[model samples]
Target: MSLLREAERCIANQGSHATLNALITTLQHLGPWLERVRDADTRRTQGTSKSAVDGRLIAIKDNICTRDLPTTCASNALDKFTSPFNATAVQQLEEAGAIVAGKSNLDEFGMGSHSINSRFGPVRSLRRNRDGESLSAGGSSGGSAVAVATAQCYAALGTDTGGSVRLPAAYTGTVGFKPSYGLISRWGVVAYANSLDTVGIIGKDVSSVREVFGVVNRPDSRDPTSLSSFTRSRIDSHLRSPALAARATSPLKIGVPLEYNISELSPSVLRAWSRSLAYMRRQGHTIHPVSLPTTTLALSAYYVLAPAEASSNLAKYDGVRYGTRSEGPNSATFPSGYLYASTRGVGFGSEVKRRILLGAFSLSADAMDNYFIQAQRVRRLVQHDFDAVFRAHQPIASGQPETNTNPEKDAVDVLICPTAPSSPPRISSLMDHNPRASPLDAYMNDVFTVPASLAGLPAISVPVTVESTIDSRDADLAGIQVIGQYGDDSLVLKVAELLDGRHL
Candidate 1:
């Protein structure tokens, strides 16, 4: 079929609303890529068969480079920055026949938890509830989540450093999948933190998420961090599954973390969690009580380690080298390096500045052993805790399996828990939160999702229902997370599918 005919077919399936605003997305950077699609179709007709995302619209986060659009990290520091190259992920999407709809907004340098840190504006979480007020779309990938939820595109790509991708999925009630670190290539993506970064996929359903994941999960010769094929095979050999049965129908042993049952967790979230566990047990899955004692230290270690890496990565943005400059009282002293100081003072946002300072402090000579070294030790313990509980052995390790600390019969296959501590909070409340509790309260949002990140494991968040007694305005509710050991992404996604449903 002709390219125009294919475009028309996609529009027909989406109905009037989707057709009218097909190219307009959360952040307005570039659009209506009709020419790009025509070019792709011409190549397709002359060359080979179509791909999974042929003629589909997809949104790329602003942090990921695109030759056609500006690659601002949603901060004025790079307001005029446009890459001369396309990120490896974007190149893969185009090769698979997907068209770039536009670039989405995000927290400045992927910093904030809620999506309000952008210079462009905050991403508002909207739905069909017939209300004018919009709650937060979770951050640093908030705009990507909103784009998928509104059907602005077939799917979108987000980079998860901490809980950027999964937390937004929980708030917006969409499917967010963060593949195991190194599974997806990171070439040409602007660095936030080198070790923790993973390219994630967000879609309206698990099927779409899985389809897109298949296309990008390949070894990239250009990316130094991309996992080699040999390592991937070894990990697959250690995966847990019944003798010859496919994992989809096999009964699972799901772990519920005892530490997540804290005083701060809301009553509504607790009820929803209880209901999800009850439903899973009815389906004949075994439920086990588990403990990761290092889980409590996860948040503190992440803040230190992420900031330290970020400080080093962002050092190149001195006005003379990378970022834009600003006029100041000391502008006349350009050669003295004072102008670089003036430009950065005006360019960076409050949150970015805060993290950069904290990161720098952690890496300083006087504080290295006390802060940086201790944080590194804690990160290792977090990974060890995860390896000890799963049935499959850690492929990265060459020796025998580590001793299991749990007294249960065997290691659980997957860990299931609430994605967030509570439902989406009203925008008004967050803006007016007490001064003392503001930033710390925001940091707590990632508390449940960060453990998997520190371990470099694959994790996903799928929406589940909340209690009826909660107000109708609270309809957005919370999500349930399923985390798997390294290379166990397929099973993690399957468990999420089995658990997805409305209130039981």
Candidate 2:
């Protein structure tokens, strides 16, 4: 089909799926995207062939910058803001012939797990509970996952800072890929946690996610943290080595992190997890029960560290510099201090404000040692725990041997686990009036996905269908995460495809 035709079809789907609120802005906001599709169609008619992703429509999360569209972050603070230039990832994809469908809704500054904290309202899941109540699509990247799930777009871009992308994909029954840190440029993405934040891809399948990743996973001069070409070449070389190649073609060593089998896991999710592992075992792969003792501390450490970084990153939005300025008589008097106070008080949502406050306290002189600094130490231990079990040596960090020697016989090539602790939670359960709901309960959603983010490793969440006895739904889906050593993205995607039964 022509690019323009595909874009039109997606736009039509977006209108029909309006109840999901997957996109914050739609037809009216897609002028630039339509122009791009038209140009791509013109080029195609002229007999020009380009990238595999060319002519495909992809959704951009609100936090990612797009020059032509308002980059709201789903917060009133920047609700009307538009970037002067496109984000590096967005530009790279467009250069490769992809079209930006529109900006999707998100948690205010990507702060919440349920995506209910957005100024634009919550993103509803395509899936529902046994009671027939709507379910959360999962946060921060909830809208992107929904867009892909409902065929509103071919794929979508989401920023995963501690499993934002993966969790949403799990809820929405889509595939989400969070590539290794520094592989994708973060130049234009709004920061949540500098250390843990990563640009991720959500699509209907692993192949689609992999294709999108290939286009934007290049070193960018604008992003200081982006991995250098030399480092990338070294990683590529390591993967092509005889030992790695032999392991790739042969039966694999997959790890099952015992730490992830928490009591909070629902019965349905646990059953799905076992089914996924059993499928891999049937394919002749070995499953080794690995211990990542530090895994238990990862979630707590992430909250502290992410909020601290967020407080720093969000400080620039004090109305004077970036955020929306308040209206009324007191708004203009900067020396009076009312301007910054009123603007922010009215601009930020409850969840964003709560995080900002938590962050502020952690960074305070009296609390830094007990909180922020301790979190940093825990983060390091988390990284160490991952390095201990993976056979592939870290390419960026020298001094470590090329391959692990300790527990070498049991070292795993990849680890498989649940992406979220449970299936999609009921949307009503996240509301303020719910007596059972609390911030702590919301934080538990990230328990399974945070360890991989803290380690800066590559991970992908693939949807698995399991038999369901709930009403007439017939089947329920769970997200199974496949994690690999830093820079082992290709291997991780391969395993995800295998579990998806593509290779079988």
Candidate 3:
């Protein structure tokens, strides 16, 4: 079917799903591409295409730039901004004949755990089992998750700085895959944290996500931090090793991080995790308890490091360059600095400003050594801890011998854990009553998901069954996260497929 026809079908059947009301923007932005469906048809018929993703409809998170559409990052500051060029991933998709459907809404600059921070409004969950109580589709990537869950697009791209993509997928009953950092280029993605930000994929299942990944995983010259060809080859070699290849085909050992069983885990989530492990064991995979000792400190280090990088990345948004400009009442009295201050003060949301200020304070000379530097050290420790647990070595370009090895010990193929500590909270509860919840409490939502992100490893969230008394009308979905070594994306998807009882 043509992309246009798929879009029409989506429009026709959209009401069947309970999606976020503020999901789509103007459809006019997609008109030119919609008119060229025949071009995609021609490419498909020609059959000798170099691009694996030809003729697909892809949804983009609001933060991913597309020359033809607005890249708002769900922030008021960039509300009127549109990029002059496509993001590296977008360009690759288009080259492969994928039609850009429309930009999906998201938490402001990928900040919130719920899609509530969007300027367009919160993205509602689509998991309506039957009494339509609104549930949060996990945040930052909530709109992307909802878009995929509702079949608004075949696959949607999201950015996972923390658990943005994985959490939403867990909440909405979809597949969310965060590739190893630097595997996919991030040249045109609006920066939240340059180091931690990674483009992720959300789809109805793991196969769809793998198909999209195959198209966009090439290194891009535009992304300075993209992994080099040398590193890619190294990762491939590790995966191709005869013993590793054999393990990949058979039921391999999977580790359940001991620290993930925290007090915050809901009974439903705990039950689901246990059930998933039991199912894996029944399938012959060994489930073992693993220790990631540094995990307790990951949230704190991430909050500091991510914001610190964000503070530096966002400095370009002064009134003189990009983003909104606000004229202070006393602009004439202080022409130079007041405009910038007023612009940022008025344009940025409260949470964003709060983060920016916190980041700036941490980077200040007084706190640099004590906070920022210490946070960096903790970040390294977090990565080190992951490296110690994973079987495969990170393919660094320097050609250094892989160290920290325990020859007698064998590492598990993948790590299994809960995607989020609990089920989705009511949007109203989060907005109105959760004011007493500290920022730290909010950050904890990504605790189980971040260590993989920090380590630049691929991870996926797959929805598992949960027994609930909450009305059947409200779809109560939860997920278990499966993490793989770098470049082991295929294995992760296979495991998710096995657990979800979907054909791989």
Q: Could you estimate the TM-score for every candidate?
A: 0.89, 0.95, 0.92
lDDT, candidate 3, 1-504, per-residue tens: 664577666544444543465354534644566656656666667875546566666889989999987888888788678899999999989887777767888888888888887777788875542356687888889988988888877888999998899999988889999998899999999999988999999988888898899989998888998987887887888778776778756778888889899998998788788878888898998887788898888888888888888888888887668887776663334654365777777677767877888899999999999999998888778777776676666556255345327341557778999999988776766663476655565677888888887777899999887555565543245788999877788788888888763211
lDDT of each: 0.79, 0.89, 0.79
Q: Name the candidate that leads on lDDT.
A: 2
Candidate 3 colliding pairs: 113-139, 130-472, 130-473, 131-473
**How well is each residue in 1-504 modelled by candidate 1, as lDDT tens digits?**
676465544444334434222222332322356666676677677775367676667788889998887888898889868899999999988888787767777888999888777888777776423355556778889888877877766788999998999998988889999999999999989999999989999988888888888888988889988988987776666553342124456678888888889888887778778878888899899899888899899999999999999999988887778977777765448576475787777788888888999999999999989999999999999998888787655667556544335443658878888888987765555553445438778888999888999999889998887656656545436788899878889988888887665565
Question: Once model 1 is optimally superposed onto the true structure by TM-score, how far is the C-alpha of residue 146 displaced, in angstroms?
Answer: 0.5
Kindly report which residue stretches of model 2 are placed more than 4 angstroms away from their true locations once superposed: 1-5, 29-47, 328-330, 334-339, 468-473, 501-504
Q: Candidate 3 versus the native: TM-score?
A: 0.92
Error of 2 at 121 (Å): 0.7
lDDT of residue 94 for candidate 3: 88
State the displacement of the C-alpha of residue 20, model 1, in Å, after optimal TM-score superposition: 16
